[model samples]
Target: MPLRSTRVAIGALAAAAMLATAVPASADDGGRQRHVNHVLLLSVDGLHQQDLAWWISHHPGSALARLADNGIDYSNAKTTFPSDSFPGMVAQVTGGSPKTTGIYYDDSYNRALLPAGTTNCATAKPGTEVTYFEQLDKNLNSIDAGQGLTGLPGSILSMTGSPEQVIDSAQLPVDPKTCQPLYPHQYLKVNTVFEVARAHNLVTAWSDKHPAYDLLQGPSGNGIQDLFTPEINSRADAAGDDWTQANSLTQQYDGYKAQAVLNQIDGYDHSRSVKLGTPAIFGMNFQSVSTGQKLPTSDGQPGGYLADGVTPGPVLADALSFVDQQIGRFIAELKKHGLWDDTDIIVSAKHGQSPTVPAQLTRIPDGPIIDALNKAWNNAGHSGTLVSFSIDDDGMLMWLSDRSPTATGFAKSFLAGYSGNGNDINGKPKPFISAGLATIRAGAQAAAMIGVPVTDSRVPDLIGIAQKGVVYTAGTSKIAEHGGDADTDRDVPILISGTGFNRSRTVDQPVATTQIAPTILHLLGLDPNELQAVRTEHTLVLPTVG
Candidate 1:
């Protein structure tokens, strides 16, 4: 079923109708507005807060600047640790973090069923758990078999390898003949803002550059419309095509996504009397900039190098500008359709890129660390010791056997040795490694190191933390990357604007991406605490409605 066609279905039609009528009016008794009927959530991949602030303040002609001037901007919005696209987006929409959602990185270690003291951590696998959308689908399944969804079709076409093979050979899951959705509703374990809005009979639409929509695979129980890029299907198809047409592949795809948003608007406008009354929510993501294999220029040009002559060039900047233009167009269209007043526009990013500098590379001898750690475990007869160590973009995560009680001690000793041997950049002593064991006992320490955080559950024995600006190098590429403790990767911009929102207000308090979902619910006058994964600490009570 194509994602565009799927409509929200309700089991109790009469109850749904009553709820729709009961949708809190935007007006208070004093004729003051109290609700935000529409929300436009936009995600710009690889955007940094500093970059956004710089462009907005310096380049008044820039679309972002215009938006910030007209809306509320959260200057200190930050993403969760182990920042990456998958986890970042998940946190943005789920109101949960890696610790709660169990989505730490793009690829994480999973050892749920493994035995303790097993040094074979190499056998651990990646996670494939339920996500936010899945929970909604199950809850709404009684409504109907919501097929012909708008976004699913495009996603399927794109996944069939129409343009290029997206997943590496090792990353491809087992073939499941049916069109696999990149935004598999099943993987999401919590209720999203979309679900909450739909419960009130509000229409919702999303456009994103990330694969969340394309990767959706499952019965969409909530019946929300999902319009996304198409995916390539078969191995033969994956091997037989050039998915790289500048105009047709990239530009056309972006245009189509934009059209999806417009179409939803049109549908709602035609069906409802008011322009803003049609779709209760609309969202779109622009990703042309991050596609550049290289960086953008520093002089605001398309392909120039950084001041240090190391980071990505102007190609990134040019791409971002292009996306900015598209955003301007989108806003213009909204105004054209007279939906500007009621619609709330939210702009943010998944993560930021690190400058790929020569001095960033740091290599610590893996042999000594791994050998000593393993020997210690083996000598203790922790036969179940499964140890898997890999170099991350900025640090190393070692999965020890589920029995290594001394995992934290060993990890500290290893870092000490690495620093003592001058393996660290700038020869600075490495101290204070972040470990999960601080909250657990000896047995729990072993479990945490293996990628299991929950007690009586499997987790990593020891997780390492690297200093900022440090990149762990294992092979050819000297590229600067994320998945570290750097503020650059972890910090992101969070902007919210719309009806009932505080106009031109800037919040200086620190906010995490995980709080977005619950905050959205709060803004809509819904119970955010109802979601099991919601973090009370992170949830911010906006001045809007509730």
Candidate 2:
């Protein structure tokens, strides 16, 4: 079935054009004359580069296939480690790793955070660190907090989402005991592409799953000119419901946000706040692909699962087809609005799901891991001090509450040679925190397994990486998942195409999502160095220009 479409009744093109805000140009920086005026970055969450390749090949001559014909495909591109959505998106905009960005997952232990508002961390004690990214706002009903469908966008095609709406209900980690709620815009430690564009007077806009993604605003002053988020995580009670189911609502909401970008191309935001005239950088993330990749259909259908060497099932095919159709619609709209020639449409994923092979999927409950952790603490002689921790991405992004060096030292020593006492659900007895002395940082042992230095407070201490394909999942429904050290978990397809992107043909050199921000800046004739994180970390940009 095709994705349902509901186009907003936009005012005449003339009115939109009248609202067009000119993108002020910087004096020619004496480099290649850049003509790329707009960027449409579509992140099809949970899409693997291989999956995209499969879909395009199957459809033969589809919109995505055409995009590949004219673009450079980074076959070896990888998402930053801790491949959770939080770090994944941050890497794209910040040009930095968790080491610098300080985000590990949607919910991770943070030594710096404190509770905000009435949402208390029941697990957090007076002297302990903070837990961040708890979506505490989901506890409300439509009428509970004056939030109801009445306030939702009348139509996705008509208005850009307010970044505020997305974060209003999220229970964010705050300063310890300060009750200062952590706002998305204020959480970023690095400047984002949106911020840099705003600094350069280039109108910018974006569409994401939730407002908390406003964290993309980074340190820039209201960097995003038009921010629209559908709050995919929200659910309203029956009294608050307008007949739309939450899942279907999220898909529809995603479409509307994507349409917001289409509206920008038409020279205005949905609300006609002003003539946006196509921001230099704008794009939307499609959750349908991600949702379909992992979930069963409402009527219970075989969803998109890639069994070793097998393509997505019928249900998944629909999702991919919908995504392709949306891209086609976007491209058509861009052409209709005369924005195609100078635009670049880049497609990538926030993270790839796991069990690329169906049989490799496992359902080892988190109990074994948690039990083993406490056991390790007991063995370390800290039996009385039960420290808090979070399984930030299946051990790949583990975080402990105790930020002290003593805790760090204990974690390293314990996990360096941890051997679970038949507690693993694998029945045959799975090992704990695998590490090899031959690996780098032999001094830190288990700490070196994750490659983060012990002094990095924002990172996890005790590393718990399961063997490739052995997922430690607490849920029974999700068989294939990501967020680990598995090779398939980290690798994602990255295709770069645009009038301004002066590169063609694939490059095998190892590259990461971190290069995206600086590359976007360079494409716009802006100084890539303006992204401080990239400069400080000596990150490399993809070879894009002449």
Candidate 3:
């Protein structure tokens, strides 16, 4: 079955062209000619380089195959460590790792901030978990995030606002210095490609699963002029299925965002009601692929592979096909609107799912690990629990109640000796943690790995990288997860198609997704140094791109 079409009626091409904003020449352009007037950046979250190669080879003449045929495919591209959606996406726009971005994960700890709803930031207890996910939504269960005039999901297609307008301030982390809610943008320590585009008088736009993606607006908080976010976590229908629950439902949810991109291509706002013209930089992320890699179908067909783990299974194959069809639609629309020649399509993933090989899989609950750590702390005569917060998947990241060397060392020692007593995905007696505890990095070492200092408030006190195939999940819903340094989580696909790309070329050199930010600026005739993170990290543009 094909994805449900949510095409929005757009105005005439001539009218949209008239409304199109011109990209002004920047002094920082340095006489570099712009090869593409518009750049469409799409993150097909959970797409691995291996998966891209397999898809193109198996499905010749498909959208992905055609893109690769005309673009430079970076076969060895990797995302950042602690490879969660937030940090991985941020790395693409900021050209920096968690160190410079100060973003470890969506739900991370900030020692300098107060808990949400703390009115008196100056007097409230410091150190709180900063959650930038659907929890911050006015109503996560509603498709419009409960911010639209009407309750129906369709009403948001013409809505003119963003999550920033509906986010409850009381739910955001309070900055002690400002005594105000620290929005996602404010939490970012550096500028983004969108900010650079905005500074150059170029219009920018984007769409994602949740409003918290407003972080893409960069530090200025207004980099994206046409930000459209319909919550993916919102209930899909009367059946109560959500985007994450089933692959089919995820495709339906992704269709809404894909239609918005089509509207942008037709020179209209995401709403398709306003003729704002095609943005200089615009695109939306696709959740279907990610969902397929993680969740089973409604029919109980599991996600991932069939033993080998390289070849996609039935549920995943359908997801790959759905995304390909969407991309085909995007290309057709761009040509219809005469924007193909002036446009470039950049496709990559924020992060990839783990334990592709079924034999390597082990599903262990995290409750035991937390309980063990806390118990160890108490046994050592600690007055309070040593663990302040933790987010575990294929790996574990923990914030400590006390970050002192002694406290950090004690916790690390305890975890190093701790053994997994959980079962595998099939309920077999397998170590949940396996031998992964040996790779734990504590305190200063953990921060140093990401190029941050020990004093960095957002740095986790301990990072435990799981052994291959060890997923810290007890539920049967998902076979895999991200947010780890495993190859399946960090190794992702990256390809740039359209004008000026080396046709049918492949680059196998090890490269990081952080390079995508500088490349975006470079492609648009803007200095890469314009992005603060690019300059700070000395990030370079991708190879073989002129």
TM-score of each: 0.65, 0.80, 0.92
Per-residue error (Å), model 2, residue 58: 1.8
Global lDDT scores for all candidate models: 0.45, 0.59, 0.77
**lDDT (Cα, 0-100) at 301 in candidate 2:** 67
Off by over 4 Å in 1: 1-33, 113-184, 208-223, 227-256, 268-279, 291-305, 308-312, 356-385, 389-391, 419-458, 473-478, 499-503, 535-538, 542-546
Per-residue lDDT of candidate 2, residues 1-546 (tens digit): 111111111110000000000111112223546557777788888788788778877887788877877777877778876667777888888788776776666555555554444346554543222222324333232211223445545533433345555345336556455455666666677888888888889988888765566677776548887876555544433445421232344456566766676777788875566786778998888876665655534325665464553588666677778888888888899889877778877888877876556555444444444456556777867744333544523333334445556765665554456443322222344343432111112124433443456655455554555454455444344444555555566778878776444445665656677777777787777878888777766665565433
> Which ranges in model 2 have alpha carbons more than 4 Å from their true place?
1-32, 117-160, 165-170, 176-179, 236-250, 271-274, 296-298, 375-385, 401-453, 500-504
After superposition, the stretches of candidate 3 with alpha carbons farther than 4 Å from their true spots are 1-34, 149-151, 433-438
Best-fitting candidate, scored by TM-score: 3
Per-residue C-alpha lDDT of model 3 across residues 1-546, encoded as one tens digit per residue: 111111101110000000000011111222435578899999998899999999999999999998998888989888888788888888888888777788777777788899888887657988887878887888878778767557476676865546698676778999888888999999999998888888888888899878888888888998898898888877877788766777877888888889999988998888888787788888889888777777634447878787888999888999999999999999999999888888989999988888788777776666666776777788888877778777777777777888999998987887777776655556677754333543877888887766677898888788888777776665455667788777888889889898555478888877788888888888877788988877777777887777
Which candidate achieves the best lDDT against the true structure? Answer: 3
Score residue 286 of candidate 1 by CA lDDT: 56
> Candidate 1 overall Cα lDDT vs. reference?
0.45
Q: For residue 377, give model 3's deviation from the true position in Å.
A: 1.1
